[model samples]
Target chain A: MSDPGTITDSGSSGEAPVTMLATPIRLDYQYTAGLSQSRFLQGIAQGKFIGQRCPACHKVYVPPRGSCPTDGVATTDPVELSNSGTVTTYCVVNVPFQGQSIEIPYICAQILLDGANIAFMGLIQELPATDVRMGMRVEAVWLPKDQWGLTMASVKYFRPNGEPDADYETFKEYL
Target chain B: MADSEVLRAPHVLEYPYVRSVGPVIGAFLTGLRDGRILGAQSRDAQGKATVIVPPTEYDPVTSADVGALVEVGQSGVVTTWSWAPEPKKDQPLDRPFAWVLVRLDGATTAMLHVVDAGSLDAMSSGMRVTARWRPAAERVGRVQDIECFVPEAANP
Candidate 1:
C-alpha cells in the first residue's frame, strides 16, 4: 500500500545486496528447408559469401540457401559473392545487453554485399563509432587465416573503403 | 514477385520445465502436501535461527549446511515490501497488490508473497499475517498452494 520503491529496511547494515531473480524463459524452435545456413556458415569461415540461384526464377540468393523463395523449389548451383558492399541502414548500439561483446557504442549495420540481391547483417569497424552512415562503401575485416570457422562472425566488422559514399537514392532500396 | 502472396508464420514455441528440488525441499513439500509449514536451522558460523519453506539446502548468506527440515508455525512478520498498482501477468493477484517479504516465525530471512490487505495503510512491516492455503482439491506441488497471506489475530 505504501510507496512501492520505499526502502522499508532503512537501517539495514550489511554488504549491499543484489537480488538476482532467476527469471525462466522457454523457447522451442523449428526449422524449414531452404538454403542450408550451415553450409553458408562454412563459407563465411573460409572468408566467402555463398548464394544460390533459383533455376526456375533466376534470382540469386546470398549465403547460398537451400531453395528459392519465389519458385518454392530447391536451388541447383551455389555462387560465391564479392566481399565489397554498400552500407544500407544501421544503428549504433550505445547500450549493452547481457553476454554482449565489443563493449557498448558499436556500429551494427545492414550491408548489401556485392553480387547478392539481399543484404546481410554485420558490424562496422575501424571508423569511429560516430562516423558510420548509410550508403557508405565498406569492406569486410576477415579473421586471422588460421582461426576462420563456419560462422559469419569471421568477417568481424566492415570499415570505410575510402571511396565516395554512395548517394542515399543509390542504396535506399537495399534498406 | 509483386503478385506473390506473403504467408507470414511464427518461428518459436514453448515446453514444460521440470525442476528437481534437493532432499530438504523435497521433505518440506511432502509436509506441505499433507498440510504443514516447514523450516530449517541455520548452521552458519553465526548459527542464526532461520525458518524457510521448501526447506533450503544451505544458509542464505553463507553456504553452510543447514539442519534437517522441521515443521514451523504458519504465522509470519512482514519485513520489506513493494506495491504493484497494476499487477503484471502471472502475478498472484489480478488486481492492485503489495508484494511483501514476510519473515515467517522462526525464519531469519524473508520470502516474497502477496499480501491481501485492503490498502497500504492497512499493511506495515512487523504486521502479523497467516497463510491462506488453496482449496484442498486444487493443491499442487508448487508455491501457489500457499496462496496469499491475510491479517491474523495478535500473537497469544
Candidate 2:
C-alpha cells in the first residue's frame, strides 16, 4: 500500500471503458445493554419500578441512564418509583405499520411517574383514545409474573388509575 | 449499589443495502464470480508497472488511471496475520482462524482475507497459501466467493 499521507496528483490517463455492477449487502448487529439500563429493566421484571437520582441535580430518572443529561454527572442513587403517575402529554397513533402488535387509533402517552423527574412513553389503554389527556393519572398494568423477563414488555401498558386529574402546576415542569 | 448486577439479553439488528460497483470494481467482482482473480495495472511515479489485487480504479501513489485488468495466480504468501480464537458472527469459519493479508503471486499489493488453517500453530508470515474458492454453483460476486485461504501444503 502507498503511504496514506503522500499526495497522488497523477490525473487519470482516461484509456478504458467504464461499466457498473449492482451489489447488495446485508448486515446484522447485536448491542449489549449498559449498566444503568440493565438494572432498570431487571427492576421491571421483578414488578418493581426503579429510578436513578442525579447526585448533582437531585432529579430522579426512571429507566435510569448512566449520566444526568442536564448536569453531565453520574446518577448514582437508585430510587423506587410509584407505578401510577400523570400523563404530561400524549399522541393518537392512527397510522398502521408492519408487525404492529396494537390496532390503529391507539394512544401513546408520556407519563411522569410519581417521584421521578423524567418521563417515559408507554401505550395507554382501557379508556377511549379521545379521552386520554394531559394531567390524567395512569397506573401500569403488569403481565403475569411467569411472563416477566429482562424487558419493559412486562408492563403490558398503562391505564387510567381512577384518580382525578392532577393539577397542571404539579406536573408542569415534566411537560 | 456496589453489589448490584446488571441485566442483559440478546438483541439483533439487521439491514439490507444495495450498491453499485463502478467500472473498475465491477470488473473485479465479475471476475470473482467467474472463478478468476483480477488485478489493476498501474505505474508508480517512476513508471514502474504495479498490479494491485482487489484493484482500485486509480493508482494510489500517482492518481493515474489504472492501466488494465490482469489475471493473477490464486496462490499467495501471508504477509501478516492475527488469530481469531473464537469466531464472531458471519466470519468465514466457526473455529479458530487467522485474519491475514496475502500477497498474490503476480500482484504488487496485498488483500485481506481469512486463512482457515484449523490451528494457530500453522499460521505465520511468509507462509504459502491458496484461495479455497467456494464451489462454482455457490459463487457470488462478493468477497466470500473465495470461502477463505488455506495453507498451500494442506491443499488436497
Candidate 3:
C-alpha cells in the first residue's frame, strides 16, 4: 500500500463534526512484591498473616516495608500474626467516587492485627458505619481457597469478631 | 529468598478523565478540523507577539494568559528530533518515524509531531517537512487530524 499518511479527497464530508472526546486510559503493570511483602502476600494466599519483627525494637510489622521506621533497622524475623485485630481508628464514607464497587455508607478503618506495630487500612463491614468505633475488634473474612492469589484480595473484608470492644488507651497512641 | 520464589500479580491502573479544552486550544483544534493550522498569539519576555502551535493557556516564558489565534503554515522546519525505531501503539505512525519539534513558518515556538521520512537516512535536523493531513471527511477536531508530516523535498 502507498503512504497511509496522505490527504486524499475521497470520502464526502456530510455529517457534523465531533468536537469533544472522553479519553479513558488504562495502564498495565507487573508489580513484583519484593521478598518481605512477597512472603506476606504468598502467606495470605494460604490463609496466613506473615509479619516481620524488628530486631532493634522487637515490634512486629504486618506486611513489612523491609525496615523499621522507628529504629531504622532491618526487620529479619518473620512473625505469624493473628488474623483478628482492633480497629485503631476509622472513618465512615458517604460520598460516592469513581471506580467505587462497594455500596455507599461503608466504614473504612485502620486495623492493628494482634502483635503487629503498624496498622493497615481495611474495610470494616457486617455492621453499621456508625457502629464502627475506635478499639472495635474485627476478624478477617477469607475468600474461597481456590480464588486465593499473591494479593491481599484473599481476605474479602473484616467483620466484628464477637469480642468486646478493646480499651481505647491500648491503641490510641498508634493512631 | 530466591527471586523466583516471590509471587507476582498483574496490576492495572485506570484513569478516566473528561476535561474541556478551553477557548485557546479549542480555536487551534477547530482550525485543524477545518483544514487549517492555527497558533496562539502570546508575547515573550521582550513583549513581542510570539505564536505557539497547539497553543498553551499561559505564555510559556511569562505565564500570562489570553491570545488571539493566528494562522500558521502547514510546512515547517524540524528543529530537533529523536528516531522512533519501533513505534508503539497509539503513536501517530505505525512504521518507523522521527518524533520531531517542528517550528512552522510564522510561528515562534515549535510543536511536537512525527515525521515519516521512510527511513533514518532521510531524517535530519533543519529538514523541511509538510503536514500530510487525513482526508476531509475523516478530519476530527483532534491532533491526529494531521496524520503525519513528510519530508517536503520528496513529497513536492
Candidate 4:
C-alpha cells in the first residue's frame, strides 16, 4: 500500500520467480468448495470437465453453484462435458493498466462447453483479436499434469479448435 | 467423475491495486516525507477558516475548492481511540498500539493515525501526541513516513 507497491520484482535465477505484489497486506483463506463444486473441481484437476444436472429442469451447470436456480433442487447428477466449446460472446481488450497479466489486443470470451446448459468465462488466444466471433468453436489448452491444481488455472486458456462456427440459432437461447 | 467428499481450496484474494492519490493527497504525503505536516485550508458555512490534515480536494463541510496547503503543528490531541491489544501484521506497530483520530494543531478536522503508547492504560481521548518520524533516508512519500505518533511531552 505504501512505496513497496511500486517495487519491480527481482526474479529468481533461470525463472521469473515473482510474487506480483508482495506488500503491506496478503489475505489467506481456506475456501470449502461445496458438494457439486468439489466434484467439478476434482474433474478439472484431472483435465476433465464435469457439470451437474438439475433433478427437475435437467439443465447442466459446469462449476455448479450446488443447486439449480429455477427448480431449487440440488444438482446431484454429474455430467462429463467435452473440452471443446463455442464462444457464445467475446470482447477484445485494447486499453492497458497496471498489474494486467495479459497484454493489449487480447480476447476474453464466454465459452459454453458442449453438453453444459450454462456458459463460463475463458481467455481466448493463439489468433488475432479481430478473427474472434460469436459462436466461434474453441477448446481448452491445459497445463502439464505436474502443474495441475484444484484451481481453474489447470486449463491455461481456450483456443480455436478448427471446428466450424456454430449457427446462432442453436445458441440463441443461451445468449 | 464425482467425488463423495467436499473439496477444500486454498484461495488467496490478492488485490494489488496501483492508484493515483491525486494532487491534493500527493502534496500531503510529500510533506510527510519532508518532516512537515500540511493541511488544506478552507472556509465553513459561516466563512470561518478551517484546516484539515490529510486533506480532501474539496472542502468536507462546504464542498468548495480548498485555498492552500498550509503547514500545521505536528503535535495533536487524540480526539478518540481504539486500542489494538493484539496488532495485525500489516499494522504500523507489531506490538500493541492504539488507532487514534488526531486533530492536529491548527486543523479543525481529525486525521486517523496510530499512537504507540506503551500499553492500553496509556491511551485516552483528548490525550496530546506528537509525530515520531522515520529517518530522512527511509522516508518515502507515505503516511507511514511518520513511524507512529508518541505521547507529547506536555501530556501528564
Interface RMSD of each: 14.0, 10.3, 10.3, 11.1
Give one digit per residue, the lDDT tens place, for model 1 in A1-175. Answer: 1221122123222222222223356554554323356556657778888787788977677765678877798876777888788889888999877559797788888888777777877888887888888889988889897878755657777888888888888767667
- Candidate 3 backbone collisions, by pair: none
DockQ versus reference, model 3: 0.26
Clashing pairs in 4: none
Give the alpha carbon lDDT tens digit for every residue of B8-122 in model 4: 7677877766556666676676666667777887889999999878877888788898877777898989999999999986779999999999999999999999999988988
Candidate 3's C-alpha runs over 4 A off are A1-29, B39-73, B86-89, B103-110
**TM per prediction:** 0.47, 0.68, 0.80, 0.72
Scored on chain A only, each candidate's TM-score is 0.75, 0.84, 0.88, 0.83
Q: How high is the lDDT of residue A25 in model 2?
A: 50
The whole-model lDDT of each prediction reads 0.69, 0.83, 0.84, 0.83
| Model 4 CA lDDT for position A93 | 94
Worst 10 residues of 1 chain B by lDDT: B1-10
Candidate of highest TM-score: 3
lDDT of 2 by residue, A1-175 (tens): 3321111112212222223444445544455567888778778879989899999889999888789999999987889999899999999999998669998799999999999998999999998898998999999999999999878889999999999999999999888
Each candidate's DockQ: 0.07, 0.22, 0.26, 0.18
The CAPRI classification for model 2 reads as incorrect
Arrange candidates by lDDT, descending.
Answer: 3, 2, 4, 1
Clash pairs, candidate 1, are A1-B120, A34-A66, A35-A65, A35-A66, A50-A64, B51-B107
In terms of lDDT, the poorest run of 10 residues in model 4 chain B is B16-25
